[model samples]
Target: MIAHLADIESMEKSFRTNLINHLTGGKAVHLIGTYNEHHQSNLAIFSNVIHIGAYPAMIGVLFRPIGENSHTYKNIQANKQFTLNQIPLSMVQQAHQTSARYPFGTSEFEACEIEEETIPEFDGPFVKHSLIKMGLIWEEEHLIKSNQTVLLVGKIQYISIEDSILLPDGHIDLGLAQSLSAGGLDTYYQLNQLTQFPYAKVLADASHEPRRNS
Candidate 1:
């Protein structure tokens, strides 16, 4: 059953939660920077990050243009570098606040009341409290004309993660991260791996694991 409401503004009049209820799972860490005309530092957070390729160790994210004039898009055009930080449940509130549209030169770190840290030689900013963070240098930028969305692709140049999250198999143990996800509108939830099956396990005969009759 689908209910299409013609009342759009009325919907926002209540609680205007982000409409993106279903993101492609495996939420990504998104950090973005853009310098305003005054050259003041502007930092923002995004969870819609995605990996584009392995051979190049690249990732891409879409930033909706800020009206007709966007300092974030311009900053990427100028500096060509940005940082991304993976958020855990602890920082959910702060991450949510970054979506606000603020003036250029406004520090989201200050607005969100979160601390910001900078690397020695990096051009963008990193979330000081995130579980994982990465620095990306621009490789390319694409403008999707029909939607006016900007797709910024960059090569990951540096990364940092908490030691506890690393597993011997070179995979991250989300169990240790306590990161969260969302389901329906405004409904946030946590996740855990119920089971990890190897290729051999799946290929094994069903009888191999089936309970035998006593």
Candidate 2:
């Protein structure tokens, strides 16, 4: 199972891709929705979405190198808005299908037979079936020179979650929402709560107590 950089590079292209992707471990799965100025909607599944900040509610999503037609990225750039919808266990199949390459202007919502939900005052569409969804406004884009990947930063403008899932201290019980995670390119996983712990703190007094000999 040991693999060095040279070994990974020498592996088959598809095998290497899957290996490297899974090496990073499980990632939160989300459906990114966007709409171009022409009103053409695009829906795509992404596992690279990351929380950047809490105060401003910023999130960063990594997009692959720009190709002839990167519909999602193009739409975000066009209108400066997008939505992230959590994929539940029941909809994993349709969520993964969103990653399929479709012709430009093709609405993955329609193609995948998923319903599109829109909120007033928001510019992009959201997955109506998702228990937790977020509307984001584009903030910035960073170019990774080494890989030519684009990191898009956006601010959360709106969030809709099922009432029963939210906790008092601001943590949402994702398990209750049946949120799914991505293991690799095509595998999806369900999660369960193992345990919860309080934040660690340093003892104010470091006095040691006598220990009884066993």
Candidate 3:
């Protein structure tokens, strides 16, 4: 179970990839939707979507290098917009199938039988069944020199959350929404909240301890 850099590098490609990807534990799984000028929609599942900031409401998705087969990336580049749809537990199979290499210009939404919708001004399509969805505007990209993977950053322009999961204080209960999480390439997980703690601050004195729950 112990692996050093040399050990990881010497492992089989697939094994190494799975090990490294799963090492990060559970990650937010989302279906990224985009379209070109002709309205040729593209939908793909991504686990690398991460929150970059909140003040301006920015998110970032890591793409595995730019290539001719990167239809999602191409669509985002063409329109500078995209949508992130949280994969529900019941639709994991359909969401995961979006990763398949479909032909160029083919709509994964159609191929996978997942429903899609559009916002008033957003060009990207959203998953109709997704309880949480976000529309974003492409802002910038950074290249990871070591592997050439591109970190594409986008600013959140719109967000839609199902009423059941939205808490009064702005916290989202993913368990209530039945949101699906990912661990590695194909494995999916269901999240359950264990507890919530108050924001940490400097202790008043040595005798004081942080509260266990909020």
Top-scoring candidate (TM-score): 3
Once fitted onto the true fold, the runs of candidate 3 whose alpha carbons sit more than 4 angstroms away are 207-214
**C-alpha TM-score for every candidate:** 0.75, 0.93, 0.93
Clashing pairs in 1: none
TM-score of 1: 0.75
> Best-fitting candidate, measured by lDDT?
3
lDDT of 2 at 134: 94
RMSD of each: 5.8, 3.5, 4.3
* Model 2: per-residue Cα lDDT over 1-214, one tens digit each: 9988899879999998898899889999999999978898899999999999999889999999989878999899889999999987888898899889999989999999999998796878999999899999999999999999999999999999888999998899988888888988888888888889899887789668888899
**Candidate 3 has which clashing residue pairs, if any?**
none
lDDT of 3 by residue, 1-214 (tens): 8888899889999998888899899998999999977898889999999999998999999999898799888888889999999998889999999999999989999999999897786768999999999999999999999999999999999999999999999999988988877999989999989998999887767566666896
The list of candidate 2 runs beyond 4 A from truth reads 203-214
